[model samples]
Target: MKDAIEVQLIDTNIYKSKELWQPYRARGAFGGQSLHAYFLLAGNVDRPIIYTVERMRDGKSYATRMVKASQRGKTIFVCNCSFSTLEEGITLSHQVTMPTVANPESLPSDLDIFQKILRSTKSESKQFLLRAEKNINDNSLIDYRAVNQYSNEEIITGNVKTDAHGRRWFKTRGALNDDMKLHACIIAYASDSGLINVAATANGLSYNSESMGMMASLDHTMWFHAPARADDWLLYDIHSPRTNHGRGVAFGKIYSSDGTLVVTTAQEGIVRLTEAEQKKRRKQLEFENGFLGNCRCQL
Candidate 1:
């Protein structure tokens, strides 16, 4: 006899596109699968997001939902997630070795990193910088620290060596109540931050660069491997294997500070820049520096 595994498909649809607006569904998937678990398990909840149930199926102890999400009027994300009634079975699994890294407290927080970056980028608009500074200093629900020690000046100057691997440690800013769904959603949102940057850093690009005017996530996928608290420091180990055609793909493995492998994620993003844009941006930076250089100088 073989160990039993159940699978189900609920419903499906094929949508058509119009010439006026961009077609949906065919483009990308949505976020909020863990929250969907809340909606399903709790059975009485309300959310602003619009979910069109693509499929719903249930077995004796498991249920699954394929959800398409939209906001305002656009299909933003989609996912196929399953939940199960707890059952006991033989359990055996293996995880890759967790990398040795510095303590989260010893590393720099996102606020620290942003402030350092702002110091080096004083040539940018003062209004924009003030807004960014305020956003970082504002009380927040998440705390993040970079495992690698690299300064903003070194990066923006393109004088630092880019590491192929990166790690981040994060936990909730405040204590979170014991809710599995809430914890999962928080982690999902946070996962999007570093993966794209890993690729950009390797290419010696910063999000602040004018040459890279636009960047957007094309698709994202996360798999919950084991239960972990979002409010506890979680280490996200990331690597980017490929970047081409204005796009880059990154893969990540998330481990709890205790060494439990909690989740895995992959995302591909569109990072577009043309040679003309680079040339134009270089001239702009040069002119701005020259103009500011002659103005009553202070450092």
Candidate 2:
């Protein structure tokens, strides 16, 4: 039982970014909005989170919830969500076509993309790469394919621009048990993955931001317009409207393969770019380059 409990917590941390309870999934149980996940600046991973949910409002067609998450008696995150039943109100025609990209079947796995980035890092980062690779192999629950090709080479050169806008296809690696709530929760989990990266990328910052200091989710909100299956390929199209004063705001829309809009999400994150970490990585990279240069001449 202890082992199972630990595994469940790990699973929750990996998928939902919340280790205590399933918040967004619970939101889908009422059926509408999402969550903004928190990353502890204290660098504590797997810290037990305590979550409490309160019913804010209940209406015929709309419902609201307030969730608070804490660690060590310190409030880490809080979210207020409102859900509404689909109304037959004014419908708008699709004006934006899904940007065509290389198909999921044709693209590299998400694991491969991460492995490339890991390998590009310094030897001290090898352990992180190894751990990440293991995690990807063992628990790759989400399948991902990007509209733009990702290049690890460019990361080393600091010229990587996967795309002007962030676009990707994501679905459960395997089928779910026909639970729509579960699917929505999975999408909520996936939404947290790169919302800020879109912002950073748009603003000429690397996803890792070699000049990085810190970045974290401030708030997350979403609205569901129609039902969707997380097990089927759904496109996540994300873009950043503006970023300044150490904050970046991003918006996303999810569409089923058939072009039906399913969900929309909004998030704002606090991003502080610093030169300290940048200087550290640059020196390490320089050492690696010098070492490689010698190896080549000697051979």
Candidate 3:
């Protein structure tokens, strides 16, 4: 029996454009997988590698999203993300500070840990593990490692809150073909693993808990501040900045173990408490239900 991690590509009409998207059933869009896709495409053209996204400057413009793709040290592709906003005076700026803990070299790979658990848990999971291993055994585009191992007995629960965020170290495992965007796209694909769960931890919620409802990412934005080398280990440190009314916001920093910040990301996800579980909790809170304000949630 062979273990496999399904990488099925969805062929919905909305996603037929391979030029802009790659359907990932378990994950999401493969092209939108990472900020690296945009960087790789832009980097291929001889231009400045840094792509900046400026949000809401004046009433005339709501947000300005700019992408500059470069290659051979020159500029190639530049795109502007546009939006409309009404005229109003509002200024706000705040971001979570990066956390310092075990460096990338100090951690294990996510795939190795996943395999260990698969073999230990269910026969089906084990078979899938074998298949996944075969799939990646030859291709060395990206490497993955899980921070803490998950199991049936222990069954880590809730969106946990800790001083150190969940950490993963990934890099290109093989040589590149000179098309930097391909590697970037691969990194985009790899970035989806376990990141959203890290945000759930903010509410003391873990995916293992049945009480936890479905969580899905609604939107993602990333800015490539500097060039990234997938061949080298890059540390992804993610944190949840806010969670209210069944929605959570997470932000992350992609850094070299040495402190070079190469990328930054912002993601909003819909987090909902299951109806059965919510009703169960509601009964227990009937006496003090008014305190939490109707227990309304929007995810």
Return the clash pairs for model 1, or none: 10-56, 11-55, 29-77, 29-78, 30-77, 30-78
RMSD of each candidate relative to the true structure: 12.0, 10.0, 12.4
lDDT of 3: 0.52
lDDT of 2 by residue, 186-294 (tens): 7776777677777777756654444646666766777777788888888889988888887888898888888888888888877667778557768999999999999
As for lDDT, the candidate ahead, 1 or 3, is 1
Sorted on lDDT, best first, the list reads 1, 2, 3
Question: How many angstroms is residue 138 displaced in model 3 relative to the true structure, after the best TM-score fit?
Answer: 14
Report the lDDT tens digits of candidate 3 across residue range 1-299.
Answer: 00011122333211112122222222322222223222222112121233333332334544444544333555433444544443358866354444566666666564555455555765444434454465335333457654554443333233344322566677765655555445454554456555666666666666545567777665566665555666667778777777778877777787765667766777676677889988987888885766456566421
* Model 1 TM-score on a 0 to 1 scale: 0.70
Taking all chains together, each candidate's TM-score versus the true structure is 0.70, 0.70, 0.56
Per-candidate local distance difference test: 0.64, 0.64, 0.52
Error of 1 at 248 (Å): 0.6
In angstroms, the error of model 1 at 95 is 0.5
Q: Total clashes, candidate 2?
A: 0
Candidate 1 vs candidate 3, TM-score winner? 1
